[model samples]
Target chain A: MKAVLGNMRAELVGAGGVVERNAYLTKRYIWWDVAWFVWTVANTLTIVFIAKGIEATGGSLDVNETMTTLLIGAVVWAYLGILFEFLMETVAWERWEGTIEYTFMAPLSRAMHLAGQGVFAIAYGLVRAIFLFCVCAFVFFSLSIPDAKYFPAFVVLVVASISFIGIGMMMSVLPLISPEKGTQLGFVAQGTLLVVSGVYYPVSVLPEWMQWIAKVSPATYALDGIRKAILEGQGLSALWSDLWPLLLIGFVSIPLGLWVFQRGEQYAKRHGKLKRSG
Target chain B: MTNIQQAAIEALPRRTAPAVDVRDLSKEFRRRDRKLGRFAHRKRVALDGVSFTMQRGETVAILGQNGSGKSTLVRLLSTLLLPDGGSAEIFGHDVVRDARAVRRLVNRVSVEASFFKKMSSSENLGYASRYYGMTSRQTRDLIPQILGRVGFPPDRRDEPMESLSRGMQQKVALARALLTSPVVLLLDEPTTGLDPRSKLEVQEFIREIRSSHDSTILLCTHDLAEAETLAERVGILDRGQLLAVEPADALRRRFGATTLEEAFFAATGRAFEADDEEDDEDREVFA
Candidate 1:
């Protein structure tokens, strides 16, 4: 038991090291992130204005309600976008810089290095998402506060985020194995998810088949849980359905994602890919 | 016994248990591609029936061109990749059976060292120190000293890695490897692209680490002078075969050549410059 704890402590220290390293990388890329945020925010405003205009023209849209929902949804979507952008850039950038091979030679497990990339994404996502959300809400809804249900919603959100990022980690490993195909597929998948995950509107309105697809999407649970909590005053028990699917997704995806990453690493090593980044 | 058997028995290097032990180690990679209307792929033998062993604390420099299986051998011994047709052990621990133990003992320094580009060299080193189980205080004290020894200027320590030169970054990379003082140090082309001065600085640092620490070094390089200077025994790896492993003088004597380059040409039956052209082709895919 003591040994296990000691190992855990060592791992934590490694994690801390990665965090420190990534913070610097994040700082270096701050300007690019700011530019991306500007573009994404502009697109969000255009979306909100269109939604409001449609409601005014006998669209049965509650102006305030629709604005609130769209505002939060857009903010949440920003997180997804940031996550995808950073995830793709992580492997591709490392490979291009010829640093990925150096990373492979480190005494630490490859997964741990990968975990640092994921951590950077999560931290970047939180900052961008919160900033975008505040800007949208202030401009559109006069800073109308979310209700008390945010507590349980936050828990469900955390679970859903893990599963989503787990899937992203799997995608991230592609560039390491086959840079050409990996990058091509990474963009396609992220684009498809953005369109189908109901980032812009409710998943319920989609056709039955589409709804099934949405249910399987990690974003569905996250959005649904958040909407129920903050918008409808739902309690923690009300989030059981959302929570369970995410738990199941996380349970299955984390191990599978990690295994795929390890396999990619091994493939790189056996095929002499380890030298390319060096 | 005849002269051949007697010579083989007499010439075998003395080793209680080899620091690196391998037998019939072969690694085959399956290459997948899409045809006009079908998928076609084939297995390529990267390392075929390779066998060799090194004694404890020996510094072995492997000289091979691109696709000569030098990096593959390093990766296998480091337990990063599995062997398809043979077995390997590091200090008697099976690379496959005791991978965790191997990982703890081994440290690798490659020419293209990875760092958080935005972070300062100090920050990167601090992180590495923590990962290797060093306390923060130890990191604070040792990093600057190590970096200075490797020729990384103190003024540049706080700047982001992206701001540093390639040679400076390589210095920091070498410093990180020494920070742990690992028992097995695998260096894959530790000074490939550096200026001559930086190259010498790195070679000196490697020498310092070997003498100060009880680390067995496996240095893979294309530089012949580097091989002669940094390693006690130089191994010639050609087309996935270890053709010879001997001291520079012994290798030259065996091949009846004046220079290490001439020795390499005589052993591999191809000109050294020809391999440079071949490397140009190998480099195209990555670029």
Candidate 2:
């Protein structure tokens, strides 16, 4: 028991140290920051202009309503962007940079190393999410107070993002296994999630079976939960229905993601893919 | 903390074990052809009946061109990939059975190192150091010193990794591998694509580490000169076969050739520069 505790302590210490280092490294790359800046400016300007036109010419629409709707749309879009970024920008980027082999060679488990990489991506997500939220609130919602339900909404958003990121990481590992075939599967998965998540519209509009699919979709949990809290002024009690599902999705996806990633790594090694690439 | 004190501590006898061992180890991969249907796929032999052993502190160079299973051998021994046919042991610990133990003893550095492209060299190295269990202060102080020894430009330490030249990036990789200084060092074409000066600097660092520290080095490379300089014994690997292992001079004399290049041709019936056609779709195994 003592040995186990010592080892765990060592691992935790190692993980903490690594996080600091990665955070420092993340600051050097303007890539994520620049990407967020461009996305925010583009979305902000478009939403403001569109809302302006909607408010013009004696439409009965409240200025607050138009602005809030635009804000909700922007936030949802940014959240979706975060999901795909995990796949293309973080996991896939590892392969393109030829660091996959290096990670395989490191002292820590591949899972932990990937976790470290995943943290950097979460940083990117947080930056974009907060920026969008702030801009929308200040310009459109009069810096409106968050509903009591916002805490639950934020929790659901985090849970959904965590689950989706795992899925994205799993898909990223596929390209390493079979470049051509794995990539095709990745595209299909990405497109399917996008269509099913109800990012741009409400899932209630979908057909019955499709609505079920959206209910279980990670994006659906995040988008719907946030839209309810921020736009509809829903409270925490209102989101209780979606809470357990988000937790279940997160619990199941994390393990599955690790298992699939490890399996893919073993397959590549057994087959001598490294040598072929060399 | 001091050099002499550390050496004395390192010298205290504890255990004697072969740093690495392998028996009948083989790995095969399946590759599908998209031009054809799903069933129109095939299996390729990556490491076929590969077997070898390395004693502590001995440096061995496996010289092979692309697709000769050099990196595959390194990966299996390091526990990055499991063998399909046989077993491998590191320090008497099975790579598969005692993988966690094996992982603690080995560190691998490859030519194509991946870094957060937006991060600077120091930041990347610090991250690797932290992952290996270094504290913040140690990483902060140690990374710059190590990078300096490897000839990394001070000014470029804070620039994004993508902005650096390949040669400079390769130097940073060598620095990262040395950060933890594991018991076994596996370098997969470590100097490939490096500029002449950077290559020499890295080679010198490897030599320094081997002599100053108790490390068993396994280097896979296509550079004959590197094989001669860094390894005490060189193994010629061709078509997943280890044709011979001996000192460079011995290998030349055995083949009745005066140079490593000539001996390679005599042994493999081809030039060192010959292009290989074999491709394995087994990368998913590593994913």
Candidate 3:
């Protein structure tokens, strides 16, 4: 029992150290962080403005209602975007810094290292998403959800992050084995999720095949739950339909992600791809 | 306290164990056989049944040209790469099965030693120390002291690693390896690309490390003089095979050559200066 406790304590300390190191790196590359922030804000604005543009051009739609829906989509998309970027770029950043070998060779288990990254990504992504949401809300003053149950919406978003992190963990292996196209492929994976998850349009509007894809995506439920909680002011009991799926996916994905990454790591070592840089 | 002193204080009870032991170790890499109609594959042997052992506190150097599997051996022993066949142990801990234990015991310094480029030398060392489970209190004073001992200029310790010269970066690498006071140090051409003065300084530091600590060193290098100067045993590895491992004078006498370079030629039937870069072109690609 004492030995197990000691081991657990070591793992926690090791994971914390990885988080601390990443925080230092983030501080060192403050410009990249700033640039990403600006890009996300611009991206959110671009989508939200389309609704405004429709209003300006005298479209037949209900302008205020349409704008509010678009604002929700924009805010949700911004949150998911940061989440995906943080998770997917985990290995790419290590490669860029040339610390992949050292990091891998450290005594810490793979579980601890990746869990550290996942935790950092979620924390950092939440902060960035909140900032983007605030800035967008300020710019689009008329964007308001009539009954905003923010607590449940926030819970859904947090739950959704677990699945996204698992997916990100899986994607990180792409770079570990193939330094050339792994990172680009990660973004491609994110783009596919975006198209299917109804980040802008309702899932019903998507093609039948895309709706099927969305059925498996935790982000789909996340978006649906958040929209209901905010747009309809639904309580936790009302959001159970979306919550269960998110929970299931989160439980499944974290372990699957870790397994896939471990296999990729072993394959990379065998093929001498771990330290290969283009 | 200096790392040497710290190592002694925290040292585990010594046993009658060799620092490293290997038996019939082999590694094969698959490469694309472009010459065989572009889709064919072949196995390129990196290490072929290589076997050796090092007693504790001994310094052994493996001399090999590029592509001669020095790095592969280091990677295998360091538990970064698993062997295709055979087994290796660090102080009785199997490298593959007990990788975590082996990792705690061995530290590697390579020419390709990587750092968080955005972080300063001190930060990099601090990160490594923490990973090795060093407390903040120990690292606060120990990191700068280690850097200083490695001949890194105190003023330059805080500069971004990207801005530092390769020589300075190599110093930081050495400092990181020493930070944990590893029992086995695997050096894979640690001074390959440094200037002569920097190379000498690193070599001197390696000598000091051997003398000051109860650590075994395995240095892999192409520099013949370096192998002769620092290591008690100089090994000649050629084309994935270890030809001989002996003292420099014994190697020269066994090959009936006047110098270590000639001894290398006598054993390998190739000039020591020959470029082996083209050898990689025929490697087998694993799908």
Candidate 4:
């Protein structure tokens, strides 16, 4: 028992190392992060303004309702996007720094190392997503809904992050196994997720085949659950349909993602793929 | 042998096990080979059935030309690269089966002083300490002490790694390796590009580590003088094979030569200056 506790303590400290090191790296690259933040805001605003654009075209509709739906889609997509990019970039950043060998050679377990990256990504993503939410929903648009259930929306967001992280962890191995075109492949995966997740529209509007794909995407349920929470004032018990799928995907995907990553890491080590960064 | 003879054999002063035991370890990498606009792949043997052993508290240097499988050997033992054949053991722990135990005991300093360039040296070392399972409080005091011992300036500990000279970066690399218990130090061409002053400084620090820390050191270098002076045993590696491993003076005497450079030529039938091009860090690698 003492040995097990000691090992656990060591793993936790190692995970904290990953978080602290990344925080320092982010501090040095603060300006680049700020620039990316600005671009994220601009892109989200462009999507949200479609409702205003429709009103300008002489369409008779409930402007506030339309804006509220678009806003939820935009902000949640941005939130999901943050987690995706952060996790995917984990591999890219390690390769770019040319420290893949050192990081892999560390005494820490692979699970703990990845957990550190995941924890950091979730924290950082939440910060950016919340900021984007405030800037868009309250500041830029001044939109509000009566009887909104913020707590349930927050719960849905937390659960969805797990599934998102699992997918991201699977993507993280690409760069390790293929140094040349791994990042471009990650972008392709992200684009596919975006199309199938109903980020900017309802899943019912997508083609029947794409709707099938959306059923597997965590973002689909996350977006639906949060929208219902905010727009319909639904509580946790009422959101069971969306919550269970998210939970199922989270539990299954996390372990599968971890297994796939371990195999890819072993492949990298055997092929000398870990040595190449450029 | 009788029971009393067996008891006497066991009582004889003998090391229980070698600090590092490598048996027929080999690694092969596939490289892309293009002929007449057709791309094919070829398997390149980086380390070919190479074997050696290191005693505890011994400092050994491997002398090799470029692309001579030195770095590949180090990487394999460090657990960064998987071997294709045979096995290795560190302090009775198999590298493949007990890699965690090996990782805890070995630290490597490669040719390239790799780090997060934007982060300070202190931050980088602090990060490494945590990965080695050192607590924050331990690293808070240990990082500076190790950094200072390597002749690093205290004022520049907070400066970004990219801002420092290659020599300074090398010092930081050495410091990071020594941050843990000095069990086994793998120095892969550690002073390759350093100026003379920095080279001497690093060499002096290595000597200090051996004498004070009782650490087993594996120094791989192309510099003949550095190998002869800093190492207790100098090994000659050519192509993918270890030609010889013995004390420097004895190696020269065995080859009937004056200097280690001449001894290398006498043994391999090639000038020490000529290097193999088949196996190198920058060679084309394929999955």
Candidate 5:
């Protein structure tokens, strides 16, 4: 038992090293981080403004409710976007820095390396998402959710991140095996999730086929649960329908992501693609 | 041999095992044949049935022109690329079956020594130390010590790696490799692009490392002088095959030539300076 615990502690420290390296890179490239933050804020506000535009154009819908819905969608989408980008960029960043060979050659397990990346992405994405939400709320002073159940929504978002990370892990391999189009393909996967997960609209309003895609998407439950808790003041028990599906997907995706990534890594090594630069 | 004697030999300490043992190792790359106009594939042999061994604390240099399979041989031993056939063992650990153990024993320094360009040399070294499972207390002092030994300028250690010259960067690469004191060091043209002064400094460091550390060194280089000066036994690799591995004087005497260059020409029937054009057609696919 002691040996097992010691092994776990060692692995955690190894993973922590990966996170530390990323933090150093982030600090060195502060401009890129700032630029990404600014872009995210602009994207959120643009989506929120569409609701205001509808009201200004004399649409029949309740403008306040529509704005609240739009705000939730925008904020949630930003969180997911950050999560996906960080996770997918895990491999791409290593390739760009030309450290992929050194990093892979290290005497650390792949699981710990990826776990470190996942932990950092989740933490960084959460902080950025919260900041973006605050900025959007302050800019649109009229926006309010009087009965917003913040705790349940936060919990749901955290749970949803697990599945998103798993998906991101799977997407990261695209760049590992194929540097040329892998990163762009990761974005395409994220975009597909965006369209199906009903980021700006209700899933019911989607075409029948896409709605089926939404059914399998962990993001769908995340959005649905967050919207319910904030807009309808739903409790944990009431949001169990969304929570369980998220957990199931989380359980399945994490292992599947790791497996696929391992396979991709093996392929990359076999084909001498680990260090290729275009 | 008697059964008792065989058992006794098997019971001997593994520390006596050769630091490196390669047997019939081979690697082939697939490339598009432009002569066949695009879709036609060709198998280009990188390393062909090459076999060699190095004792502990010995340095062996493999000399070859560009694309002569020196890099491929180093890559195979380091577990960076899978062999198309045969096996390589580091301290009796198989490169393929026991890769994790081999990784713990081997450290590679290549011509293209990659670093996080945005991070400082100190940070990069610190990160590597941690990955190698060194405690923070050990790294705090050890990183600076290693950098100083490699002759990296102390004042510029904290500057971003991108701001440093290529020679300075190469020094950091050497420092990173030595931090863990790996049992096997595979250097693939480590001083390829350095200035003459820097190259001499690096070569001097390589010599110092072999004396100071109980490690085996496999250095692959195209510089005949570097090969002759640093390694005990110099190997000539041509067209993916090792023609001869012997001391510089021995090789010259065997070919009845006064210089190592003439000896190489006599062995391979090609000038040592001639480029292998087949390398241009070699293509790699990531997928």
Candidate 6:
């Protein structure tokens, strides 16, 4: 029992260290982050403005309601994007910093290292997502949806992050096996998720085959649940159908992602590919 | 600590076996020849049939020119690279089978002092120490202490690593490795790019580490003087093979030469200055 506790303690400390290093990296590159955040805000605004665009042109859609839906979609998309970017670029970050060898050879397990990175990404992504959502809804769009239940919407966002992180973790393995093109390949997963996950639109709009693919993406459930909660003022009890799938994906994908990453790491070590950009 | 933890700690000193036991260790790289054929590939044997052992607290230097498998050997021992053949055991823990244990026992300082350049020196050290299981309280004291011992400027601890000189960066790297007092400290050309004064300070710091810590040092370098002065035994690695590993004086005597440089020439059958594939195409297959 004592040994188990000690091991847990070590893992926690090691994971915390990974998060702390990233925080330091973030702090050091604060200006760059700010620039990216501004870009993200603008992107969010452009998507949410589509609702206003339709209303301005005399479309029959309810302007405020359409704007809120778009706003929620854009916010979730931004959150998921940040989460995936942080996790997927983990290897790129280590290599760019020329610390891949040191990190790979550390006593800490790969799982713990990734968990620390996950913690940082979730927290950072959530903060950005909240601010983005606020800017798009209240400041820029002046969206006021009566009877909207925000608490349940937040719960959906929090739960959905688990599955997104799992998928992100799986994508992070690409750079380990193929450093030359692996980082670019990570975006393929993101792009696929974006296409099939119904980020800015409803699932009913996608074709039959694409809708089948959308069913597998946790973001599909996430968008569904958040819309129900925020637009229709649904509670968690009514959102159980969406919540369980996210939980299941989180359960299976995290372990599967860890397994895939370890295999990729072994392949890298055998091929002598862990060195920085070589 | 539990009984298991206590037992593991107590069993750390396997005096019966060498601190590092590498047997017939080999590693090869598969490189493609785009100029030759579309699918043509050849193997470069970076380390071929190399075997050595280090006793507890021993400092052995492997002197080699560029691409002579010095870094490959260090990387293999540190669990950063997998060996193609043979086996290496660190204090009874196999590098492959018991990599986690070996990782705890070993730390390496490579030729390039890699760090998060945006972070401060203290911040980098703090990250390293924490990953090795040291708490914040411990690193708070140990980071500055280790930096001081390695001659890092106390005033510059908070400055970004990129702003620091290469010599200073190298100091931080060494400090990170020694933060946990690893049993086997692998220094792969730690002073390779330092200026003369900085080189001397690094060498001095290494000697201090040798005397102060119980760490067994495996110093791989191209510097002949560094091999002679810092290590009790010197090894000459040419191409992919180890020609000799012995005391500096003994090597010179065996080669019937008055100087260590002459001994290197005698063993490798080439002038010290002229030995290498630096300018050549290096397309030769190892076999």
Chain A TM-score relative to the true structure, per candidate: 0.87, 0.78, 0.94, 0.95, 0.95, 0.96
Of 2 and 3, which scores higher on TM-score?
3
Question: How many clashes in candidate 1?
Answer: 1
Q: Taking chain A of candidate 2, what TM-score results? A: 0.78
lDDT of 2 by residue, B46-160 (tens): 6778778888889999887777788778878777677788888877778887776676667788767667787788777776666555666766777788789778888889888
Q: Give lDDT tens digits, candidate 4, residues A221-266.
A: 9989988998899999999999999999999999988898899888
- Candidate 6 residue pairs in backbone clash: none
- By descending DockQ, how would the candidates be arranged? 6, 4, 5, 3, 2, 1
- For each candidate, C-alpha RMSD in Å? 6.6, 4.7, 2.8, 5.2, 4.7, 2.6
- By lDDT: ranked, best first: 6, 4, 5, 3, 1, 2
- In model 6, which runs have C-alpha deviations exceeding 4 angstroms? B1-13, B275-287
Worst ten-residue run, lDDT, model 1 chain B? B1-10
Stretches of candidate 4 exceeding 4 Å from the true structure: B1-15, B36-39, B276-287
Candidate 3 CA-lDDT value: 0.82
Candidate that scores best on DockQ:
6
What docking class should model 3 receive? medium
CAPRI class of candidate 4:
medium
- Model 3 CA lDDT for position B79: 79
- Write the number of the candidate with greater DockQ, choosing between 3 and 4: 4
TM-score, candidate 5, is 0.93
Top candidate when judged by lDDT against the true structure: 6
**Relative to the unseen true structure, what is the C-alpha lDDT of residue A211 in candidate 1, on a scale of 0 to 100?**
81
Q: Runs in model 5 with CA error above 4 Å? A: A1-7, B1-13, B33-38, B276-287
Tell me the number of clashing residue pairs for each predicted model: 1, 15, 7, 0, 0, 0
Q: What's the ranking of the predictions by TM-score, best on top?
A: 6, 4, 5, 3, 1, 2
Provide DockQ values for all models, in the order shown. 0.34, 0.40, 0.54, 0.67, 0.56, 0.69
